[model samples]
Target: MTSLTRAEIGALGEQLAVEHLRTLGLVVLDRNWRCRYGELDVIAADDATRTAVFVEVKTRTSDRFGGVQQAVTPDKVRRLRRLAGLWLAGQDKGWAAVRIDVIGVRIGRQRTPEITHLQAVV
Candidate 1:
């Protein structure tokens, strides 16, 4: 089998995360939204709860670097919060709740990739 580049893996992970979110009924608002500070992997809305979800996707082939869960550090969460605020500020609509989420995608090991989503990381 051929190996995938880091960018390719990350893209696949984000796509999988989007699909997973859609299956859970969240409507995707934006993807790869970027600003000077940083980039937001996925932005989705939970219409039923009137909530906006900001997601950070981490893709990995193995757990050598402490796995995906350990990838989002406290500082990273702070940055994500700031980025989320920046994104929200540009919206004309309001949300009852806003949340930060982390989605971990692990591929190339099993027949199907594994996805782990942690919501409300704040």
Candidate 2:
């Protein structure tokens, strides 16, 4: 078995997150959206709720250092919240509600990837 690179792992995690969000009825508006401050991993819309969601994805091969979710620190959550505002400023239409979310992906040997989605993180 071969190990994936950091970029590859992150890409896989984001893709999986998008798929999972879509399954939950969210329409993906963008991925890897960047601004002068930082990047937003995923931006999606919950049509039913008229809400815009900003998602941060963290991928890890193991929990030796920390769990994938632990990677999203308070500072990171704050940054994501700011980035969400920046994203909205660039949008033509307004959303009824906005939220920040975190998606943790863990890939282990001989096992399917594990995904955890935490909404309204910030």
Candidate 3:
């Protein structure tokens, strides 16, 4: 298969992440939600737990910089939190809890893309 562009890779990674979330029974509320502060890659709700999960997707062809786990720095987490808050502010529904999740999608290394999910990341 041909290599995908960076933005295409990102979009594919997010699509895979959404499928993963659905498999876990989370209802996808929004995707690519943006604000002046930043963008939220995925916004999902766990109705069973009454929680809102904000996901950040990082798609890489290689780990030259760092692994997916290492890609999210403290500063990035803070920014994601702020963006999540902005998204929540526009919602009429209330959630008992809010969480930040990171999903790393590694592609072109195998027959299928690899996904790693870190939930409730601080």
Model 2, range 1-122, lDDT digits (tens) per residue? 68778999889988999999999999999999998999999999999989999998988787876875678889988888889999999889879999998888888743788898888876
**Candidate 3 RMSD computed on C-alpha atoms after optimal superposition onto the true structure:** 0.8
| Every candidate's CA RMSD | 0.7, 1.2, 0.8
Candidate 1 segments whose C-alpha is farther than 4 A from its true place: none
Model 3 — TM-score against the truth?
0.97
TM-score of 2: 0.94
Ranking by TM-score: 1, 3, 2
Give the clash count for each candidate.
Answer: 0, 0, 0
lDDT of candidate 2 at residue 28, scale 0 to 100: 98
For model 1, how does the per-residue alpha-carbon lDDT over 11-119 read when each residue is reduced to its tens digit?
Answer: 9999999999999999999999999999999999999999999999999898888776689999999999999999999999999999999999989778999999998
Of 2 and 3, the candidate ahead on lDDT is: 3
Candidate 3 whole-model C-alpha lDDT, 0 to 1: 0.93
Better of 1 and 3 by lDDT: 1
Q: Provide the overall lDDT of each model, using Cα atoms, as 2-decimal numbers.
A: 0.94, 0.89, 0.93
After TM-score superposition, the amount by which residue 115's alpha carbon in candidate 2 deviates from its true location, in angstroms, is 0.6
Clashing pairs in 2: none
